[model samples]
Target: MNDNLAVLRGYFDAMKAGGPPAAMPFYAEDVVLEVPGAHPAAGIYRGHAGVGEFGATMARLTGGTFRLVPEDLLAGEEHVVTVATASANGVSWRRLILSTVRDGKLATVRFFEGDQALVDQVLSA
Candidate 1:
């Protein structure tokens, strides 16, 4: 397996083990987190602090039911993509996340939701 894939896997493992906080080690200090939508959680989050806030806000907007469980990791030269599911309100919204890694730490993340309606329902409700 590529080191990037392993790192990505570890990142997901961290999330499962300790939620967002545990995943911090895999992210750069100035990482960019982006969630595009009309939902309250949608926006650009910068740096470690911003990423932490991103996780919290997403959880709050989803009524504390939001979680991303990665099922697969695909790696490129400097980018990794995770196939994951965002679960909330007993619904699983499949998703694709493109993560840019620099010097073994995540620098930027862009997430694409497979079912926007499900996400909106979870966030808006």
Candidate 2:
């Protein structure tokens, strides 16, 4: 893993271990998180308020745990691809997130959930 990828992974690992507060260090002031069917987060989350809201929602729906486990790490000129497993809600889903990093911070993250059927079943259960 390159420096940026390592940093990004560290950020995600922190989220998995300690929730939002631990993940705050990896985001920029103008971070943009694009989760499907949800509004975008377009600014700095100084605390865990915004991030917590998002996590709580997911937790409620999943009834298990949701995490981003990077399978493939690819660094490009300004972006990276992190193929991860989003397991929770009694289901395991695979997804790919394309993120653009600027100044060592995450500027934008575009996530594509791969198994819509499984995700729907879990969320609707």
TM-score of each: 0.93, 0.76
Please provide, for model 1 over 20-90, each residue's C-alpha lDDT reduced to its tens digit, 9 standing for 90 to 100.
78989999998999887778888999999999898888777767876677788899889999998779878
Local accuracy of candidate 2 as per-residue lDDT tens digits, 37-96: 323222223323455665666667656466557777778768878888877745677889
Off by over 4 Å in 2: 37-49
lDDT of 2 at 118: 59
Tell me the lDDT of model 2 at 120: 60
Model 1: per-residue Cα lDDT at residue 7? 82
